[model samples]
Target: MGGPDSLTKDTAHDVASHRIASVEGENGGGKEDAKDNALQALSTFLRDDMEACNREIVARMQSPVPLIPQLGAHLVAAGGKRLRPLLTLAAARLCGYEPSPERQRHVGLAACVEFIHTATLLHDDVVDESTLRRGLASANAVFGNKASVLVGDFLFARSFQLMTADGSLKVMAILSAASATIAEGEVLQMATQNDLSTPIERYLEVIHGKTAALFAAACRVGAVVAGRPEAEEAALEAYGTNLGMAFQLVDDALDYAADQQVLGKTVGDDMREGKITLPVLAAYQAGNEEDRAFWLRVIETGEQHDEDLPHALDLIARTGAIQTTLERAQSYARAAMQALDIFPESEIRQLLMDAASYTVSRVN
Candidate 1:
C-alpha cells in the first residue's frame, strides 16, 4: 500500500463522489461531519486496501454467461455505502495489520464479504418484492425474479470459493455460520410478517440473525485474518454487532417516516407490505380499543386501503413510537462505542465511533 499522503488524496475523491448531501448549519456541522465521516473517513484511511478489494470484487463478478455479470454489474454500479466490506477492512487495520502479503489476503476476504451482502440483497428484493435499491431499480426489478435468484446463488457460490481459498477454519466457520443465520433470519421475518402479535424479543431475534450476524462475522474475519488474540477479536465482533443493531433499528423506523428523499423509497412501505416493525409494534401495543380494531383490520386481515397509512402515522405519532425507537438505537450506539474501549485511541477508532453515531443520525 502507498503512504498516507497518497491514500488520503485518493480516498477523499472517492468520498466526495459518493457522499450524501451535507446538512447545512445543522448542529453546527457536527451532524453533517458525523454522517460524512461514517464511510469517508474509513475509506480515506483504508484507501489502498479498499481499492484492491474493489478490483477483486469486479473481477470475480464476471462470468461468460452474459446474464450473470450483467445483473451483477448493474448492482455494482448502483450506489450503496458498501459498508460491510469497509467494516472488514477497517477492523483489520484497527487490530494493527498493515500492508503486506498477509495483509493483502484481507483484500479478497473483504470482497467476499461484499459478495455475501450483495447476494442477500438480491434475494431480499425478490422476497420483499422491493422495486428500488439505493435509489435505483433493484436487481429483481430489472432482471426477472428467477434470474435474480440464480445470480444470487452464483454470488454465494463465489463467496464460498473465496472463503475456501483463505483455508482458515475459523474464517470458514464464521462466514458459514453468518450465512446460515442470515437465511434463518429471513425465514423468521417472513414467518412473523403481518402478525402484530410478534414480540419485541422475537423481532430482535430476527434482526440479530439477518443483520447483526453478518456484521459481527465481517469484523471477526478481519481479526482472524490478522491473527489477533481472541480478546481483540471478540471486541471487534461486539462493536460490529451493536453497530448493526443500531443500523437496522433506524432502518425499520424510517420505513414509516415522512421524508422519502432520505429513505429513497416510499414511506410506509413496511406497512404496505404488512411488515411488523418496531414503530408499528409500539403503536399497536399502546393503542386504544378502536385503534386495536383498526390495526387488526388492516394488518392481520391485509385490508389496508390508501387512507390507512395516514391513520397509521397518526397512531404512531400519538404513541411516540419513532422517538422510542430512536432512543433504543442510541443505546445500541453507545454500547458499540464502549466495545472500542480495549483499543488505544486512534483516528481509526474515532471514525468508527462516528460511524456508530451516523447509524442513528438518519432520523435527524
Candidate 2:
C-alpha cells in the first residue's frame, strides 16, 4: 500500500525468528554452531520479507464491502506473531528461492497465507460466538455476527481470487484442499462439542483438520510456488504439520495454564464453551471416576464457577495432562526438525528447525 519502510523488512524478520529454536547435535560443538549460523542467515532475510508482507496486506485489503475493511483491519492490526506467512517464506527459502526477483513474488504468497489466516479468525469468532480476539473485541462481537460471517465469506472469496490471479493451478489446489480440510475440521469440532463421550483420538483428528491443515498448506504452497523438489515439498509439508500440531497442543494447554493477560484471551474459554481439546482429553483419560464426573458436570451442564477452576486444574495437573500435552507438542516439534534434513545444511534450515522447537514452548 505504502512504501516498504512502513513495515520495514528489518522489523518483520525479528518477529519471525522468535517462533523456533535450533536442534542440538550430540557433539554439542557442531550442531549448535551450524544452527546458529542458519538462524543468523534466516533472521536477516525474514525481516525484509515480513515487512513486505505487512505492507501488501495493508494495501491489498482495500475493499468495496464496508465490513471487509473494518473487520480485516481489526484482525490484521491485532499484531499476531504472523507464523503462517513466516512458514511460507521459510519453505520457499528451503526450496531454493533465494534473494532475487522471484523472492518478491514469494512475499505475495506469504501475504496470502496471512490473509487466509486472518479470514479464518473472522469466521471462527462468529462460530465460537467469541466476544474477544487478539486482546480486543472480536469482529463478531463489535460488528455483529451476521456482518462477521458475511465479511468472513468475503475474505475467503478474496483469498481465492488472489490465488487465481497468481495463475498457479497447483497453488489453487493446495489452498482449495486446505480450505476443505478446515471446513471439515470445523464440522468435526461442532459434532464433538458438549459431547463428553468424545475420545482423545477424535480430538487430535479435529485439531489436525482445523489448525494444522493450513500450516501444512502454507509450507507446501511455498515450496511448490518456488519450484522446489518433491523431497523439499514433503519436508515443508511435514514441518508445517508438526509445527501446527505443536501450536494447537500449546494453545490447548494455555487455556488451562496461562494467565488471561498473557494469553490475550479469557481463561477457561474452551472449557466454558465445551470444546474438548487435547489436554482435556488427556485429563479425562487419566482421571478417576469422581474427577471424571466433576468434569462431565461442569462441561456438559455448564455448572462451573471460578472455585471449580482450581480443582479442575488440579485434576488435569495431577494426571500429568499438562505435561502430557507438552510432550505431544514436543514430539511434533521434533518431527518438524527431522523433515528439514533434505535441504542441504544451511543457516536458514537451522533457523526453521529451531523455530519448530520454540513454537511449542513459547509462553506468549
Candidate 3:
C-alpha cells in the first residue's frame, strides 16, 4: 500500500488503452492544439487577479482586534488555487466586461465568490474535525473551533455585503440560494456520516447539493451578472456543474490513490471518516459477499482504522471499483464539453474546455 500506485493486471490493460487515447488527445492538432494554446494564455488574465485579490484579501481581513490578526491572516494566507474566483473573472470577460467600458465589476464579484468559499471551508473543518487543509493545520486546528466558526460567520456577513455592492438582484439571488443550499448539504452529509449503507443515488445527491450546486450557481452569477446571453449563461452553469462533479470525483479518487504528500491529506482518510464516495459505491456493487461483509464490519461499524486501508484498496481493486469510478468522472467531463457547444469558437471558450478536461483527469 505504501508503494507506487500500480493497477492489477486486468486494469493495466485499460490503462494502456487510456494512455493511447491520452497521447492522441495531447498531440491532436487544430481544435485541441488551439484549446491548449488558449488555456496557456489565460495566465495573463487570471494571474493579476489571483495575486492582487490575494493581497487585498489579506488587507481586507485585517481588523483592529488581536484575534482577527492571527486567525484572518492564517486563513487568507492558506494556499488555494482560487478557481472559483477565476471562473467568475472568465465569465465576466466572456460576457464582455470591459475595464474601461463598464468598470471591472468582475473583481468585486470574484472576491465575493472567494470570501464565501473560504468561509465555508473554515466551518467545514470544524464540522469534520479536520486537522489538515492544503497540507497544513486547518484553521480550526490553529485557531480553535469556536474562533473558526465565529470568524467564518464574520466572513459570511462580509461576503453578503460585497454581493450587495454588485448591485444586481439576479446575482444576489443566485448566491443567496447557493449559500442556503450549501448549508443544507452540510446537514445532509452529517446525517449520513459513516453510513456505509448510503446508496449511490444518495451519495450523488449529497455531492450535487453540497459541492456542485455552488459551482453551478457561482458560474451562473458570473455569466448572468456580466449580461451574457441566456443560452451562454446556461452553458457556463452546466460547465460549472460538470467541472465541479469532475473535480470532486478526482478528489475522491486521490483520497484513495494518492500519497499524503501529494494529496495534502492521508490516503484512505475518507474511508477512515466513513465517507461513502464513488469508489466505495463501485466496490459495493462489484465486491463479493465477503468483501461486502468486510466493508460493513469496518465502515458501517464506524471502526475503520489506518490498518483497514489495504483491505479497502484490495477490495476496491478486486471489484474494479477504481476503474469504474474513473470512467464516471470522464463521462462527466465529456458531458461538460458538450455543453460548451453553445459558445462560439474563441480562445477563452476553448481554454475553458481544456481546463475542464484537466480538472477531471488530474493524477493528484
User: Which clashing pairs does model 2 show?
Assistant: 9-47, 9-48, 13-47, 20-354, 20-355, 21-354, 21-355, 22-354, 38-347
The number of residue pairs in model 1 that clash at the backbone is 0
Give the whole-model CA lDDT for all candidates, comma-separated: 0.81, 0.76, 0.72
Q: Candidate 2 — what's its lDDT?
A: 0.76
Give the alpha carbon lDDT tens digit for every residue of 1-364 in model 2: 2222333333333322222211111112444343534433344556667666666766566665444555555555456677788788878877777656553767777777777787788788888888877677776777688877777777677678778777889888988899889899989998998777898789889999989999999999888878877777888899899889998989999989988888888878898888888778788878989988988888878788878878878888899989999998999999988988878898678778878877776765
- lDDT by residue (tens digit), candidate 1, 230-276: 99999999999999999999998888774876677678878878888
Candidate 1: how large is its RMSD?
7.3
**Model 3, global lDDT:** 0.72
The residue ranges of model 2 lying beyond 4 angstroms of the native Cα positions read: 1-44, 99-103
- Please write out the lDDT profile of model 3 over residues 1-364, one tens digit for every residue: 1111233433433343443334333433445344434433353445554444454455456555545545664553345556787787776666665655345567777777888888899898887789888787787877689988988888888778878887888889888888898888778877887776788778777877778778787677767766778887888889888877877888888887777887876678778777889898788778778888878877778766666889888888788787777788888889878888877787667667777788765655
* TM-score, cand. 2 vs. native: 0.86
TM-score leader? 1
Off by over 4 Å in 1: 1-36, 101-103
Rank by lDDT, descending? 1, 2, 3
What's model 1's TM-score? 0.89
165 Cα displacement, candidate 1 (Å): 1.4
